[model samples]
Target: MIDRAIKLWFFSALVWLVIGPAIGAFQSLQFIAPDWMNFLSAIALPYSKLRIVHTNTVILGWIVMTFISAALFMVPRLCNTPLRFPQLAYAAGWIWNAALVLDLVLIWAAIPDSFWLSIQAGEYAEAPLLVDVMIVAAVVCVIASLHLTVFARERPHLYVSVWYLLGGLYTTAITYLVGNFLVLAFSGEGYQVIEAWWLHNAVGMIITPLGLGTAYYIVPLAAQQPLYSHRLSIVGFWTLMAFYPGTGLHHFLQMPVPIWINEFAVISSVLLGIPVLAVVTNFLATPRGNWSRAFDSYPLRFAALGTLYYLATCLQGPFQATAAVNWYVHFTEWVQAHAHLALAGAFTCYGMAAGYYMFPRITGRQLYSRGLASVTFWCMVIFFPIFYIGFTWSGVATGASINLMGNTIYQTINITWIPRLSRTITGTVVVVGFIAYVWLLLRSLRVGAPYESGMNEVPEMGIETPFEEARA
Candidate 1:
């Protein structure tokens, strides 16, 4: 049943959420405990390798799986159809699980850092070769979902959300091939540069679009309003497609790449504010004269805060792309703050909101609790700023001190223990927030009851659903 699939994906995603952060916390502590963490210390175990495992699990395993769950739930309903091959979709789910297991195996088997380098050359090894195969399988599952939903069915104009979904899948597959095979594996002296370029683009293209697209679809719907402007949505989509890929080079701000490429990336990253502002304008316009509606609705609160965070993240994103700022912030915890704000604060908010909005409709059951959802939203809002300010403060303060300490960079950076300890504290706070979120969601899913009578109602738009009409 739909309930089982929903539960399966949500639970699996939560498992990753728990494990990824725990590993990340351990990784963060290594800055202070380089030699002292006896239980964790190993000669062969490189930080780079552990970091990759942590990063990839959170990004690919957690985000992708959770997004897939949301997509599976939404595509069928929006298209007014059931999944074409539910069994195949279920099988695809198993493939994803198997892939994650294989990834862990490869990690445990001591996949060399050189194996990742092979990604750029478009070659594979015994271990990385397996990782590559797993990635391909995961992508195949994604492609199948796309084909079944958008390609297989007859419908009116394709929804904007579906367009973004398909676009994300297509570009992800292309980027995987180029990043892992062509650029990283094939290119040597310039391999790191290319890989970073691809990573930057992949995050922008794949994760942001899919997350934003899902929000675009669900937020207005939850608010019980039509999108403020379809025209603006089109503008947002096309401009994003044109600009986002080009912004990848901003990560290499001072590095030795073609000057033209750096300039191109700088301009594009900054210009990306245009599409971001456009979407913000569109979303803000949705609540014209109805701002109180957002206050009243749990889902609306999440959506509104997400839009605000989007603005903050994009503005900061382009600002950091500048060479002047990158000089001080590059590879610092400042960058980490930017990343968590974008991925965790913004994208994850949208994802969680979408999950709450769709779950009842998809399951043909009312939500378990609006009260718990409200608690989750506020926890998220409060959580983001605590980590944001702490990490940014630590990054700027420490970065400045390091620069001023001595004539040489290494000498300046010698006093790092306290700063690293601060980071551990900041990361711990973020983990606590995540724990709050998991608890709130669990209560909402299992214990809270469906809203009764007037409590269930959202404001009116033009929804024709029995649930909507009844709630209204």
Candidate 2:
């Protein structure tokens, strides 16, 4: 039953992966040609609505669901127990996916005149009130199921992965409720401040913890080693909980909110590097002397690269959060690039790594093709960097033109046209790569090489040697 739930969540996430990036590619085209989507205007699917759809679909539908699947799989294994309430877990998956679909429909149904049906315009909390309620309920069910599993653990000691996963689950439920409802209940000049907190926590609290938890579990396993430092892991986890919740204020530093709040946010944002370094150090050190194994293993390769991207995203985040830097890049394409770095670059990579690692184990089938997996990895590695570089270049050029040369938005657009065009091209490469990835996943489900049962030998370097065993 738990295996079925994992497959459902994982495959559903891949389906959203296809949908979200297609919308993102269309959004990039809109940047180049504002009227490109004009034909769809008759149906009220404007850029704003589609933008929300893209963000929500990728974040909640793809990244969140995928990580949840990882949690469902990893938590039980770590605890040495069966998943409690398998039926509830399955129901939660359906409810979560349904809420995402309903949220998108509500966004589309909100014609210009029918504004009431539109979702709340919060950054990460854009679901309609009803959709929000449904999501909260789904999360509640997930928490209950997972917690029950944790309580039934046969393992005497809770592993580090268990700490991160259980803590993340509890925090996510509270974070969602507070961001979607509690914050909205208040009204004042400080509303924007409150909203910023919610927006920041949505990413920092929910996605970051979940992504890190998945990585922590996969990294040592892929490398065939114990964690580099258990103390560092604990420190990293606690520091993340302490610092991440307050760092949202940096997003609104240029606003009229209190200056001290912004300063604290900046301090917290910069200090976040501590936890990032600790976690990265632990994972990187664990792969020592076994790096070549990663080259041969697709899951290890993905996990390794994901950690690198995670490091880059964290470093870039602190630099951008500084006041002087924020003044120039806050409203520019730089911020968009940064967002992609975190969501698409960092967490998406982790989620995919987890999927690749677990799918074969859960389904008892080898992947369809190593060559195809390599292609998918190269596409992401080559194209996503190009995509981010083009966008960052466009942002810097546009910002310089506006601040230094006194250019209008029209002039900046014309000046940055080359990078914008490159962004669209590279984004298309990413979308195609993702499509192929999804195809590979689905094909493997039906026709991949079958796993031989009762082969329990731990090969050298902790690699799965059977597929290569036959090839050799």
Candidate 3:
């Protein structure tokens, strides 16, 4: 039952991996030539709506599905027990996908806001009241399933990955409700404050911990190493929960919010480095003796790349949140680029790592072709940064010309033509990688090489996983 359940969510995540990014690539074309996407407008696929769809699908759809699949696979193994209720896990995945479809369909419908509907308020929180209710139901089911799995544990010790994932899921529920429902209770300035909080934390609290938690499990396994320091893992986990929630308002520093709010957000953003460093250092150091394996293992390489992207994101996030930097970069694509670094850049890589590692195990077969996987991986290594650079370059260039030089929009528009073209081209290239990845998965299922079942065997790592060490 659990096997069937894991496969359901895993394949669903692969489906979204292709879809969500394809929408984004199409949207990028609009910037390259405003009329390029005019046809999409005929079906109400205009850039405004499509942008919201792309973000929600990728984050709530793709990343959320991937991590849930990861947790379903990992929890029972770490707990030394089968999932408490496998059917609930299976039902939750389907429910989550149903909610996603409703969410996307309603977005395309462009439903108007009403007392009951709450069509669109914040960036990713744009789902209508109906969609929000469905999503909250799905999240609740997931939370219950995971906790029940932990409760049924035959092993006494819990792994750090479990800690991060369970804690992350709880926060996901809290932030989602607060951002989507609680804000409805307020208006005027308070509403904007809630929007800003949800906007940033939608990534910070939701994606950051979940992605990092997936990384914590995958990195050591692919490298065939014991966790470097349980002590550091604990610090990273605690500090993250402490500092991340308040930092959400940092996204709104330019607005006329309270000075105290600004100062608090800035302080919280800066303090995030403590957990960020601890986490990154732990992953990087874990592979010290087995660096060669990363080159050989697709999972490790993607995980390693994810760690680097995460480091770059956290370092840049706080720096930009500062008054000196946000004042400048906020005007440009810098914030958008930073977002991609976390969601599209880092977490996507982590999702890929999870899929690449788990798929072979799930199916009891070796991957069909490492060569095909290489095509996807290299595309990521080469084109992702190109896309990110072109994106960041376009924004910074536009911001400086308009904000710094005091040039009008007309003059700056002329200057931005080439950079926008570059952004579109590189973005399309990144999407090609996504397509290749999905194709590889489909093809592997049909022709993957035969392999022995590790499902019944002891874990290859041989280290203790009854729980995370240095127990709280």
Weakest 10 consecutive residues, lDDT, candidate 1? 117-126
lDDT of each: 0.67, 0.84, 0.84
Q: Put down candidate 3 lDDT per residue, 123-174, tens digits, no spaces.
A: 7888888888888887788888889989988877677888888888898889
Candidate 1 C-alpha lDDT tens digits along 1-472: 4446655665677677767766777787666776655445465456655676677677776776677776666666556566665655566666667766676666666535564412212211122645666676666765676567665655544556666766777777777666766663445538756666676876787787777777777667666676677667767888888899888778777787778988898899988987898789877877776777776666677778888888899999889999878778776778888887887778777767776665555444455556655656765776557657766766776677665553354543455556556657766766665666566666555655564333322222223323344445
What is the Å distance of residue 90 in model 2 from its true position? 0.6
Give the clash count for model 1: 11
What are the runs in model 2 whose C-alpha is more than 4 Å off?
111-117, 452-472
TM-score for candidate 3 = 0.95
Candidate ordering by TM-score (highest first): 3, 2, 1
TM-score on alpha carbons, each prediction: 0.85, 0.94, 0.95
lDDT of candidate 3 vs native?
0.84
Worst 10 residues of 2 by lDDT: 456-465
